[model samples]
Target: MTDIIIDGGTLTASRQDRVVRGLLLPYREECRSNIGRFSFAPGVVEIPQDLTGMSLNIEHERERVVGAVTELRETPAGILATFSIAKTPAGDAALSDIEAGRRVHLSAEVAGVKVKDGKGIAGSLFAAGLVEKPAFPSATLLAAEDTSDDEDDPQGGDDTETTHSESEYVDEDGNVWRMVVDTETETDGDTTTTTTTVVEEVTENPDETTDTEEEEDPMPATLAAKAKTPTPPRGRTRQRPSIADDLPTLYATVAQARAGDQQALTLLAALTDTKISGTGALPGAGVLQESWQGQLWQGKSYDRKYINQGTLGTNISAAGKSGFKMARGTKASPKTKLGGDWAGNKTELPTGTANAEKFGSTLARWAFAGDIAREFFDLPGGAELIEAMFRLIAEDYAIWSDEKALATFLKLAGAPVAPKTYPSEYNDSLGMLLQGILAVKRAKDEPSFAIVNSTAYEQLLYTPHEKVPEFVSFDITTELRGTADAGKVYVVEAADSYFVDADDDPLVDEGEPAVLVGAKAGVEFDELGEVPFTIDALEIAKGGVDRATHGYLQTFEIRPESFVLIGSAPVVGG
Candidate 1:
C-alpha cells in the first residue's frame, strides 16, 4: 500500500476543570487520501446523532475499545464530542498518553459510505480512533480527564456513564469471552432505528482478558423500521439567516454622524459601544482615534499580510541608484598546475566571458482615501469618524501592498522548473511541495520557504506525506489570486518581483497554472516620501474633505534561478 502523509495542527492540552472537550470532526474540511482527496460535510455521518455509545478505539481497532462518546453537539466549526474513558488498563494508558502529549489526534472510521464530489456525503460514524497522526487537522484530542479517582477500579466506573458496559464469562469450551455492549436509539420521522454493537473478545485464560486480541463483527446488529415508501435523494438544505448575518453599514453611519445628526451619532455610539468623549469628535472617540499608520500592527491577524521584500529576501535602501547591475558568471576551468615548464612556457587558461546586466525597480503610488462632508466636523464624533476612516484605509493598503508584492514576485521568477508537471498519479499537494523543494535544490540553492494560497494550504494539511523537510517552512497568503492559480505553490531561496509565467497556456493536466519565486535580496522596495495621512477641504460647493495616505514603492532586481514554482491539478469540487 502507498504510504499516507498529512500536514496539520498539533494536539494541545489545557486545564479546564474535570471535563475534556475538543473539536471532533471539522465540517467541510478536505483531506487527501491514497485514492484521492476526500472530506466530510456536516450531514455525511448517519447515526443516532448524539453518538452516545460510539466507542473510542486505538487506530480504528474496535476490539481495543478504550472509551465511549458520552455527549455530542453540532457546532459551526464541526461536531464537538466528549469522551468517557473506560476504567480498563488500556483505557488508562490511552488517557495517560493523551494528557502527557503522547497520543495526538483522532481519526473517525465510517461504514456504508455514499461519496459524491470527493466528499463523504453519506456515511455512518462507526468508531473514532486515537492515533499518532490524523487526516483532519482539526480532529484534535483536546483533553482527557480521568473521572475515576481510583484509577484501577475494575467495574469501569458505572456511576459516571451508562452508554456502554462490559462483562466476561467462560464458555462451555473453556474459553473466556468478553462482551462489549453499546446501546443507542434514533427516530427519523415516524420510524425509529435502534443500533446495538455487541462485540466479543475471546481469550483462553480469564487473567489475559485485557491482553487478548479480537476483531469486531463485520456488521453490527441494527434494527430498522419497515419503510412505507421509497425515500428520495437528499438535496441542498436551507439554513436560517443568523443574527450576525445582518451586516452593519459603517460608512453610512460615519457619514451621518459627520452631518451632526443626533440619531446617527447615537446609533454610531451604540454600535461602537464604548466610553464616549464629546470633545467635538466622533462618538466612541477612543476607537475612532486608533492609528493604523507606520506599521502593520494587525500582522498576526489571518486576514492581514506580512510578506514583503524584507520578509522574503534582503531589504535595502534604494541608495539613489536608478538601476542595479550585476555580472552573470560563465563556467570556466581553473588554471592547470604550474609544473614541468615553469619559467619559459606559459599555457593559456580556460577563458569565459561574464554577461553584465542592469535591472531597475518600478515605482507605483498606492493609497486608500475617503471623502467626508464639512458638517461632520461639528459633531463630537466627527473627528472620531475621520480617524476611523484613516485606520480603515491604512489596513486596506497593508493588504493590497502584499498582493502587489506577490504578483510582482511571480512575474520575475522566470520559467517553471524542468519537468514541472507534478506527478499526475498522486493527488497530494504536499507531494507537489516536496517536488518544488527538490527542484530549487537542483538549481543549487537551498530552499528557505514556500508560499501557497489558503486553498492550497488546506490541501497540504490533508495530503499525507512521510515527512516535510525540516530545512524549509511553509507560508500561506490569501493574495495568491485566481481560483485555478490557487493550486500552485512556490519554493524559494529568497524573493524578487515582476514574474513571467513559465507556461503561457495551461492544460487540464495541471501544467503551469501559475509561477512565482525569486530571491528577496534581488528585489528592492523603496517607500519614497512620507506616507502621511492628509486631509484637504474640498471646494466650497462640495463642502467635504478628501483624506488620503500617499506613498510610492520603487526599484527591484530579480534573480529567477532562486525560486521554483510547483503546480498541481486543480482539486475537483473545490
Candidate 2:
C-alpha cells in the first residue's frame, strides 16, 4: 500500500499557529502490537508550544538563522514551526529579499505492512523543509481532511458501489444475494453475454478479512452535480388547455379602439409626453396645502372679471318682471334698478412690471442615474412649488393692493372710520369688524366674510386673555376661516398676511396693519380661456443652451385690498 501525503500549511505574519500543528497529520495513539512496541499512528508526537527565543537553522545551517521559531506544535504529518524574523540589520536584509508563501516539501517513512496486530503499513512524517514557494492559493488555517470510512472515502481504497444485474449464483450456505454487473451481446444468428465477478472467502479471522478493503473511484471533474428536485412520480405534462373562444372579444375591442376611441392616438401622446418630461409621477402631486387647498374659487380666467370694480353691476339678485299681465292698461312694467358703485369706488388695481425668479438646479444627473422616472409630486418641494409661485405673487400683492372692499364693508357696518390711530381693544377693533359684517347683511341682505393676517387673528384668539370684556370665548375655526362663537364677527386667516413690513399709505404709521375684505368686492382675474393663476414650465437658456429647471406663473387681474392700519397701544407714561 502506498502512503497518502498532503503537503500544505500556513505561516501567517502574526506567528499564531501553535496547536494547529496537529492538523498536519492524522491523530492516533501509540499501542503495543503483537509484533512489538510501536504506534498505530506513527506521526503522533508531543510538540513544543513556545519557542519564542529559539533560532531557525535554515537547511540545518546555523549561519543562516534569520528568524526565531516563535511557536511549534505536533500535527498529523509533523510538527508545525511558527517563526518570525528578528528586526536586526542582517535579519531585515534577509527578509526584504525573501519571497513569502507556505507549502513546503516534507519527507515521510513507513514502518511495516500488515492489517491486524498493527501489521498494515503505518505512514509517518520524518523531515520537513522549506523548499520552493507554493503556487496554489493559501489560507490562514489548514483544511480538515476527509474523514469518511477508509474503504468508502473517495480519497482511495473503495469499489463496492454498483448497479446492473439483480441475481447471481452464490453458494453461501443457501443464502441468496443480488449481484450487480453489465453485459453486452452480439448476434451473427447467435447471441452472447459476458460479465465480471469475484468470489470471497467466509473468514472468521479479523486479520484475514481486513485485506478485503475496497477502493472508491475518483469523481469526474467535468460533470456538474446538483440536488435532485422531488416530485410525485408517474406524472407528466403532455398538453395545454384551450382558450380559443376569448379571441373574438379581444379582437373586437382592438377594432373599436382603432376606429372610434382613438386610443392609439391618446396612448401615443401620453407616452411621448411622459418620455419627454421624464416625470412618471403618480396620479397627483400629493402636496399638503391643508390650510387652503379647495377654499377659494378654482376656475378658468373666463370665469373671473377684470372690469372696473367701482362700476361692476350689483344686479346679481336684482328682481324685475319679464312676464306680461293680461287685459291690463298698457301692461304694468317696472324698470330694473341698479345700485351705484358704493363699494370699491376707487379700488384700482395697479399695473407694474411683473417680477419673477427661478431657484432650481439641473435634473440631468437625477434623471439619468436611474432607469425609472422619479415622481416629483411626492417629493417635499414637488407640487408645493406651484403654490409657492402664487404665494410669492400674493405677498407683493398684499403690500400695495387697495383696501376698497375693506372700506366698503366697514361703511355698510357703520364703522367707516372705526379703525382709528388708537382704537380701543375690542371696542372699535373687534366692534367695527362685527358691525361691518352686520351692515353688509342689512344693505346686501347677505352674509359678509373678513380675511385677516394670522398674527391679528392670534390676538383675537387670546382676546379674553388680553383682559377684554366683549370676547367671551373665541375659537379659531380655520376650516370655516372664521370664529365659532364670534357672533357676527366672522374672521378668516391669511397664511401670507404678515408678508410685508409696513404699509406706505401715509394715512397711519401704526406698527401692525391688517386688511379686511368681502367675498364679492375685489376685481376679477379673467382671460379668454385660461385659469386666473396658471403654472407653466420654460426651458430657460442664455446662449441657446438649456440652463436650469425653472417654472413660470401667470396671474391676471390679481389685485389685493387697500391694507388698513391698526392703532398702537395707548401710552401709559403720562
TM-score versus the correct structure, for each prediction: 0.36, 0.27
Write model 2 residue lDDT over 1-574, tens digit each, in one string: 2222222233323222111111122222122212222223433333334444455333323465556554444422233343465566755544333323333221112222232342224443322322223211111123222111113435443233211222222222322222121211222123222222211112122333333333322111111122222221221111111112234533453465557654322111001122322265434454423465633554322111112222233221112112222221222432233233444668754322322322221110110011111233446655465455455444333322223323333333221233443345563445435544444454443333455555455656655546543432344654535543323334655543222333422222233434353434322311122112333333234212221222212112111232222333223342
- In model 1, the worst 10-residue window by lDDT is 238-247
Local distance difference test, candidate 2? 0.31
lDDT per residue for candidate 1 within 1-574, as digits (tens), equals: 1112222222222233222334455555555342344556655565555665688777655689887877554433345445677777997788678777777566555555444555556656555666666554333323323232213235543221213434444434445534343434444445554444434345464453443344433223333343222122222221111122111453464456557655443211001212456654446535656664534455443342325432332232445335544453532533333234334357555444454456655666676566778777766756876776676666666666666666555555444543344565444455555666566567665444465444445555554444444443444335432121222333322222222233433212332223233344545555534443464657577887776676455546455666656544344465
**Top model number, TM-score:** 1
By summed lDDT, the worst window of 10 consecutive residues in model 2 runs over 361-370
Shift of residue 300 alpha carbon in model 2, Å: 20
